[model samples]
Every structure is written in C-alpha cells, then in structure tokens.
Target: MTISFSDLPIRDEFRGMTPYGAPQAPLPVALNVNENTHPIPDDVATDIVDSVSLAVRDLNRYPDREFSLLREAFAGYLGHGLSAENVWAANGSNEVLQHILQAFAGPDRTVMGFGPTYSMYPLLTQATGAQWFAGERGPDFSLTAASAVAQVEEVNPNVILLCAPNNPTGTPLPLDVIAAVYDATDGIVVVDEAYFEFAPHDAPSALTLLDGRPRLVVSRTMSKAFAFAGARVGYLAADPAFIDALRLVRLPYHLSSLTQVAALAALRHADTMLATVDNIVEQRDRISATLTALGYRPYESWTNFVLFGGVADPQATFLALYERGILIRDVGIPGHMRVSAGTEEETTAFLDALASLEF
Candidate 1:
C-alpha cells in the first residue's frame, strides 16, 4: 500500500530531480552557506521591528502590489541613475531569478549558463520548463569574451545567466565577457551580482553597461553584504520594459507588508548595515592566504566565501571540521570545498579547525 513519490503522476521533468539543499546543521561555528555571520546591529533591528509592528496593524489590507516605496528605496541605494521604474524585487534573489525565467524562458525556449557556476541556474531553467544549456568555462573556472561569445553563438539561447564572481569557484566574470556574450545573443541577459558588494570598490559593475541594453539585467541580494539573509530581500535593475514583463507572471501582492517594511527599514540603514563588508573582505583574504600556506589552491574570490582545492579527501576534511563543531561546504567539486568568511572569531575557529585537519 506504500506509494513512493515516483508513483505519483508528477511531471516527467521532476521525477528524479532533487531540491536545492545546502546542508543545515547546528554547529557552533558554521560557515557552510555564504551567510553574513554578523548579527544586525541592535539599533537597526529595533527600527525594523518598529516598522514591522506598524505594518502589522494594517494586516487586514493587502500589501502594495507594486511595492512602489521599496522599489524607489532600492533604486536610491543602487545609485546608478536608476529609478523605481527600472527596479524589481522579490522575496530573495532566487525568486527574482525565477520571475525572470518565468517571463523570458519557458517551454520551447533555452536558458544557458556556464558550467560549475551557481548551482541554481539550471534548476531554475528546468522549473520554468525551459531547456538548460550549460556552456563552458576555462580550466581555472574563468570565462573569456571569446569563449563566452562562441558559446552564445552556438546555443543562441533564449536567456543567458552570468554569475559574476561565480559560486563554487569564486572566479569573477569580466565586463568585457558579459558585453561580448550579450552582443552575440538576442536573448535576455542576466548578471547575478549577489557578491559584488564584497568585490573591490573600484571594480566596475554590470550596471555600468545597462544603458541602451534593454535585454540586460543586474541582480543583487541583501543576504551577503547587508547581513540581511534572514530578511530575504533581493532585487534587480533592468529596462523598465523588462520589469513590466515580470509583472505578468508574478503573483499578485507577492511581497507581504512585513517583508516590504523590513526591507525598507534595512535600506534606511544601508550605510550602517554595509559597514561589515570591509571586515568580511579581510576575513576572506585571511582564509585565502592561510589556505595557500596550507598548500591548498585557494581561488581568488570577490565574494564572501573562499573555494579552495588540494584536499586529498574532501569528505574526510569536511567531516573532520564538522566533528569540531565547524561547518563548511563540499560543493561537489573534486578535491575542493568552500567556506564563508565569518566574523573574526568565527573565521579563526574555522581556520583553526581546517588547519588541524591533517589532510
């Protein structure tokens, strides 16, 4: 009488597919997922609580379908001559990405991304019923303009996803590569800059190329630099027409009143909330330098985490750190693992635990 999930009349696409899971464990020093380990400053938390409390009083009313104020705040924070008309937001960057795919890629369309990039790109594409076309990167996980353009020409996909400072490898995508790829295809081009705030201040953003590029989108999240992972606010900037397209597919009043107000409160304290970036960058560098000294090849990262290779046995090293109440990620890359840059003490704990592992 027992029926497995496979026995259900589910869509063929989902039969063997697994959910996106980053291992969740209750370890004392957790650096597994790339979360900002710093707690929200007390003052900021108080203001957020105040905002949420006020919003709760109007619970009978549906939240703003447009989320106009929040969008304006985001545009201001981004400060690239952007306005509310050019920005869109969702519960998280993942949802923002989902909306893009739903609007621009589905069924007969193809969505492409370079391999060993963000693990979510293909998953999102598949969920949208779009064919996922995985392109290639250089051996060092780098993507050049020529290589990217060539791949775009081959696929001619309906959508191209570029993860700047790609996950799992932490290799940054240059602006020229993005520009070349965009020119090579007539499809929607998305640049996920979830980690851009952690990059050097002088590094140019994909936003700089947004002018006259109606098909281009630049996405960001509060999860890393803003220490607002729990708040789950993510947004993007693109042509106003592109933002309008997402509206066609999104649920009405998708962002709740609580979510909107909390995000607005966080945006109000942008400078204070982002002050942790410098410290996190320092810790990230510390992780990379120590990994190199430990004979591991730590890739140059513009993100909050470090992806290091040279472990003789990744699982063994992962477990050893876990046993010591320190958690990191084994991102399914052979001889490699990733760890977030945590607060100073937390970083020290992870580094000490990793160093003690004989492998």
Candidate 2:
C-alpha cells in the first residue's frame, strides 16, 4: 500500500485520528444533544413501528434512490411552497449540510458562518479544506444587518450560513436582517431553521423568500420538535438551483427505507407533535424564568433549550450533572452549558440540580 501513500499529498488533518462516535447518544437524561425530551404517543409510535416494519420488507431492494415520497410529505408539512425539486435530505441535517458544501465549496474557495453558533459548521468546512470565516455576532447573539453586510464585503465567501433560532443560544435572525444579507452577497445563503416549531414570533422562515432570492435555502429537521432524532431525518427547502447543488453531491439511495418510514409516521402525526412543541415552548420559558430566579442569566430562547450564564465553572457543572445521571452540553468552551428543555418532570429535575449548586 506504499506505506499508506505517504508520498502523496493526502489530507493530513484526519490521518492521525480515529473516528469517534458523535457526542449524540448514550448519555444520562440525554439532554446534551438537544433532542426532543418527549416520547411518541401510542398512535404515532404504532405508525412508525408499522411503517418501518413494512419498509423493512424492502431491505433487499434499493431505496427510492431519490426518497421522493418522503420529500413530498416534508414539503407539505413545512408550508414553504416546497416542491420535490426544491427538497433534499440525508441521514441528518448535518449530512445535508455536507452535501451542499461538497457540491458548492472547494479547497480554493471559502465558507462563512456566524460565531458562537453551531460547533459543526467550522468542522464541516475544515473537512473539505475550505477557509472557514467566523463572522462575529453582537454580544446578545443577534446579527445586525449592518454587521452582516460589512462582514460579507470582507469575507467574500462562496457560501454564507445563518442559523435562525440558532443552536446554543437560540436567538433567531430577523427577516429584514436576512434580506440585508441577501442584498449584500451574490453567493448562496442558507437559513438554518432547525428550531422553527418553537419560534412562532421570531421571524417568518426564510423559506417563503425563495421566490425573491433564488440563492436562499432553508433547512429543517424532524430531530428537534418531531422527536425523531434517532430516526436521522432532516430536510432542506430552497430555490431549484440550490437544491440541485445538494443533489449533485448526495449519494445514490442515501436516505434509507428506515428513515423514510419513520419520517412518514411523524408527518402523519404532525398535529400531535405540534401539541408537543407547544408543551416544549411552555417548558422552555418556565425553565428560563426559573433559571433567572436562581440567579443565572438565561438568554431569550426561541428553541427548546436554554443557554444560561452561570456562576459556576462549566466543566465542573457538566461533571456534576453527569455524575447525577443528567447530561447537557458545555458548549463553545467553558462557563456555558446548553441544557435541553425536557418534559415538565425533566425540567424540574434540571432545576433541582441547578438549585443545589453552591454558585
């Protein structure tokens, strides 16, 4: 094997590291991954189990190759005027993101995203040897049109990403702010609405804007609000051009029969899941108020989790929660933890844990 092709200029970044499991599963309380904390209702559970059982029978056959039915159903759910041509999916939104980058980005170009946002964005860019730009966000974690406009002029990237109702802090981007960024950049702009179900008033999803700006793309997931994290189903809606870019990079028959069936079941129970989203919204605010009452400064969240400024060390608190059989992510470095909003009972358990802390 020529000693692993040492003479070639193969990528050096991944060569020394063994692949590790995603920091997504097997944790106590499992809140670190920001999953929906509710279990599926009996009827919805039956739908999934039954659908998957039927799908399993087709195991020897290839997947739909395009996952057409799943895409169509997803379009109908989000109310984004989504079409099959404007939709693409993968094992998860993470993989959908990778497909976009693989098709649109290259070693000679760049990708830009805001700071204190998703941890995976920068990592994903680096995987392709693309220059990753971290445009700074305001101290409050919202993007200003002026700031974003200025950064676009400087970064001159091929793609720009905005995680509306973003991860960690959950601050949603305003629509006018998104329009301003679109006006300033000729490159692709992705508005990640991973938490849209919890964000009714923050901003109308950029999905509807696809008519005005063909460069716009909106990504949504069943993982968060639909309680389908384990099913690995995520969808993206965009202008046909952007959607085609994703298609170019997606593997043939990538979405398994397993994921497609599970998502169909979730869609069938959309109203029931929306009810769960209502409960999650209530729990999130309740947790926020409780966090403030306990002297922690929690951000105005539009997602299911709360990001709080605590008096204790983040690593120490993470360990404490871990020892106590609960888990939350100590994200973007020390002193901050992104704790998911669970059921009222789970929220109470987290509140109790916080109350027991000395600082």
Candidate 3:
C-alpha cells in the first residue's frame, strides 16, 4: 500500500511546514531570486569547458574528499594571510552553514539570528534538532552593536548568524557590531558575506577579525561575484581548528571533481567573471534612485538587489509585474518588494514596467 507523507510518522515539528524556496518560473525577465543575471563571458566559458573535459575521464574515481587544491585556490583569492588550513568549502553557502550547525550546534543547543534576515537560518537549525531564537532587528531592519550584543547575552546561543549586506534588506552591518557580538558570546559566530563583492570596495570583511577569534567564521560564495551560481561553490574562512571541526560533520567526497574543475577554471578568470559587478552596482543605484523619485522608499543597498517600500499593495504590484513577464520578489515584507540588478536591458524593462504602473 502507498502512504502519503503525513500518513507516515514524519517528525512532529515538521508536520505542516512547507519547504523554503523562491519562485523559479521561466519568465522572460526572471529576477525573483538575487542571482547575478549575467552570462559567463565567452573566454571564461571556453576555459571551464576545457577544464571539465579533463575531469570527465576521472569520473570513475571519487573526488578529493578534502578538496585540498580547491581550498588553496580559494585561500589565494581571499588574500587575508589565509592559507588552505583556514579555508573550507561545500556545495553552497547554505550547505557550508549546515555543516557548521551540525558540528557546533545540535540536539539541546540553541541558535539565534536577527529577524528579517536570511530565512534559511531557522530552517537549517531545525534540521539539526537545535532550537532557534530569532532576535529582533531595529526599526529600519538594521542592528546595532548594542542591540546585537544584548541579544547575544540574553540568549547565549550555541550559534549566531549575522548577515552582511543582509538579505531582503540589502544593508551592511558595521564591523563594530560583529566584533561586539563576538565579545559578548562564546557561541559560534557566523558572518554570512554572500553579497560581499557587491558592497563598496572599501567595505571590510569579518575575515579581518579572525586573527584571535577562533569561534568566528566568515562565509562567502562564488555564486554571486564569480557568477558561478550553477557551479554551487561556497566557502568559509575561520581558524584552522574550526575548519577541522566542519570536516567531522560533512559527508565524504561531498564536492565532485567536475565542480572543482569548473570553480577553479572560473577562479583563473576572476577579473573577467567579476567585470560586470560595477555595471550591476550602477543598475542597483539607478533602481534605488528612480524608485525614490517615484515616491517609493528604497533602502540604501550595498548589494546587487534593492528593497523598496511604500507600495500601495505589494502582492498587487508583484502580480502586475508578473503578468508583464517581469518577475521580482515579494520577500514577505509588507509594502515592500525586491528586484535583482539585472543586465542593462533587463533592468530597463523592469523600470519601464514599473514606470507605467499606476501605483
């Protein structure tokens, strides 16, 4: 006899909970998710193809479980006195985070993060049987060192998630706030820097704080800056001991040989891969400026997406844009929606569609 999912004894906590994801329909101007909307340059594509072909003949063997060479290449790119010993990687930043939670927090332990941040934090914590405490962010969806330290003191969680250029809001937290939180908590502190490359060149990374902070982990992704989302390579820089801890929880040979090849190939052409960043940043600023001029409130963004408020009806606006084949994200924020910085043409199309709307 066939049994439905609920019919079987699934975990009680996940009984009625749905999975997390953004809309992924094949729209003409798809920008719902915060993906780098640029295609790989022709030169980069050729190099990636050549590298993958070299790895195809070795499919019979398992990829290096530790991904040692990849780690070294990643370390070289980071350039903060980091070596392979200080770096670790996984399928994506999410998986890297999961491995972290699995190793450092589980069962009776607790994890905490500020609200209106990355939605995946709680879900990932739940998967590890750890309790989640979502602390509140400030009115503007920003958090201060005082507020963050206060929450860390109160909750004393085993893990804490801090997003830089935070998701949905696109605001970067001050480095002082991160330092303060680290000082206030003995728990593992994860600084998610998925959008770091989008931030201003002068913006500092949490990596600078890793000198004496063994519990602090700074996570980054190639998906955003490198435009290698399809390759799914995300990584972290932390103390060597912390990197070793993650090894205990991650599955063996998790990163495939082909993935390593593609990522390394892309890394060789880092300049080419990141050439469109300035262009994307320009579009992001333009979108923010235009939205503000139109009587909407666009929050200051250091990331590739802009989060704007003052929509008469977010759902209505979302639907209207969808009907026009211009997909953006509602992000569950009232009176607000987010649009990724697409190519010039795509951005122009979205702006034109918004310009014609009554609201």
Candidate 4:
C-alpha cells in the first residue's frame, strides 16, 4: 500500500505545506522564474570546464570547508571595501538565508518583512521555528522610511528582511528606508540584494552601509547577475562576527569542489559573465513601457522582470501565453503577474503575444 504524505509522522505545521516554487512547464519563450535566459558565452563555459577539471583530482578529499579563495573572489566582486572576513557563501541565497536564521532566529523569536515581498522569506523563517509576519507596503508597492520604521517599531522582531528590487514587485528600496528600519530594530537587519546588478545605475548597495552596522547583513546571489543559476552559488557581506556566526551553523564542507571551481571560473570572467546585463535591462524597460502603452499598469522595474497589474484575468492570460508556447508568472497577486526579461527574440514573442490578446 502506498503511504500518503499525510499519513507520515510529519510535524503538524508541515502536514499540508507545499514547497515554494513557480510552475516549471517546458515551453518555448519561457519568461517566468526571473532567470537570466541568456546562454553562457562560449569562453565562460570553456573556463568553467577547465576549472572543474583542475578540481577533479582532489575529489576524493573533502572540499574547502572554509572556501577561502572562493570567499576572496566573491568579496572582490562585491567590492564595497569588503574582505573575505566579511563574506560568507552557500549553495544559493536561500541557503545563505537559512544559515542566517539558523544562527540568529528560532522558537521564541519573530521575523518581519514588507508585504508582497519574496515568498521564501517567510517560509525560511518558518523552517527555523520562528514566527514570521508581514508589514504592509504603500500604494504602488512602495516602501517608505516612515512606513518601514513604523513596522519595525511595531513588531520589534528579532530579525527583519528587506528586499531591494523586491521579488514579485520589482521595486527597489531606498537606502534611507533601510537605515530607518535598521535604527528601529535592535535585531538582525537583512537586506536581500538578490537583484542588485539589475538596479538602476544610481542605486547604491547596502554593502556601503556595513561598516558601522555590525548587525546589518547584505545577501546576494550569483544565480541572477553572473548568469550562473545552474551553479547555485550565493553569498553575503556583513561584519566579520556575522560571518563567523554563520560559519557555526553551516555544515562542514557544504560547498562542493565543483561548485567552488565553477563559481571561481565565473568570477574570473566577470565582465563576460555580466555582459548581457545591459541588454536584459533594456528588455525590462521595453516590457514596462510597452505594457504601459497597452493600458496595463507595469510597476517600475529595477530588476530583469516586471510586475504588472490591471490584467483582466491573470490565470486566463497566463494560460493563453502558455498555449502560444510562452510562459509568464502569475505570482498569485490579484490581477498582477510578473515576467522575466528573456533573450530579445523570446521577449519579443511575449510582448507580441500580449499585444495579440483581445482582453
């Protein structure tokens, strides 16, 4: 007899939970999931293969538990006066965040984020046995300093999550607001800059704010900007103490030799790896502009994706796009949906499909 998941001795809180993920249908012109969608340049691919080959000889031994060289490479990439001592790496930003929660938050603690933010923030908090709650965003998904401070004051959570170029909305937060929130909360303040490279040129990184604030942690991921989503490398910059805290919680040799080598190879070719960022930005603007012209309300996007509102029927529109061999995300936010900027041809297909729709 087949045992249902419900019949297993799972924790009551997890009895009916579904893992967080977007639909993964194999369709042409796929624009969901906020992936880079650009193929790795040939030179980068070759470099990755060569680097991995070098690591193959040492596979029998444990990989670098410290990941020292990899940490230096990442610190150099982040470059806001960061050193390897201030950096920590994990399989992805999600795991990086998990390490943080494991270190700072648990049972009696609470974590808070602005509403309609990244879905994983709450899920990750739950996994740590912490209470997760949401503060509301202003009209147009805007997060203001005043509003952020009010939420921090009200909740007084042990940890606070702020996402720049926030997921599902594509809105970047102002540093002033982050500072305000930081001032209000004595606990850990995490600024998730997963889409930092996609933000406007004038936007500043939270890394610059790290010096005086030992409790501030800025998390980033190579999956988005470096176009190495397949490599699953993510990292963060914070006070050396914070990095040390994460070290205690992370498993020994968690980063595989192959992952380390692949990430190092990509960082070495950083220019080539990030060469398409500009193009993706252009596509993002095009999507926002064209959507606006089509009488849809597309939020100002600082990321590779746009979250647009005023769809008459998001599910129907989503299914229609799927039928036309294109796929976009519904994001389950009322009449709004999000779509990632794909290659030019793929992006054009998505726009053309939307243009063809009668509603």
Error of 3 at 121 (Å): 0.8
Per-residue lDDT of model 1, residues 133-217, tens digit only: 9898888899999999988998899999999989878788899999998889899999999999999999999999999999999
Quote the lDDT for 256 in model 2: 84
Error of 3 at 184 (Å): 0.3
- Residue lDDT tens for model 4, 33-86: 889999899989999999999999999999989999999999999898889999
Judged by whole-model lDDT over C-alpha atoms, candidate 2 comes out at 0.82
TM-score of 3: 0.98
- RMSD, candidate 1, Å: 0.8
lDDT per residue (tens digit) for residues 166-256 in model 2: 7878898888888988989888888889898899754577886778788888888888988888788778888777777676777888988
What is the TM-score (0 to 1) of candidate 4? 0.98
Q: TM-score order of candidates, best first?
A: 1, 4, 3, 2
Error of 4 at 201 (Å): 1.7
Off by over 4 Å in 3: 1-4
Model 3 poorest 10 in a row by lDDT:
4-13
lDDT of 3 at 294: 83
lDDT of 2 at 39: 86
lDDT of 3 by residue, 1-359 (tens): 99778777988877878899888888899887889999999989999999999999999999999898899999999999999999999999999999999999889999999989898999999999999999998878899999999889989999999999799899889999999999998889999999999999998888899999999999999988788888899999999999889989999899999999898899889889999999999999999999988888999898999999998898889889999999999988888999999999999999999988985
**Candidate 2: deviation at residue 325, Å?**
2.1
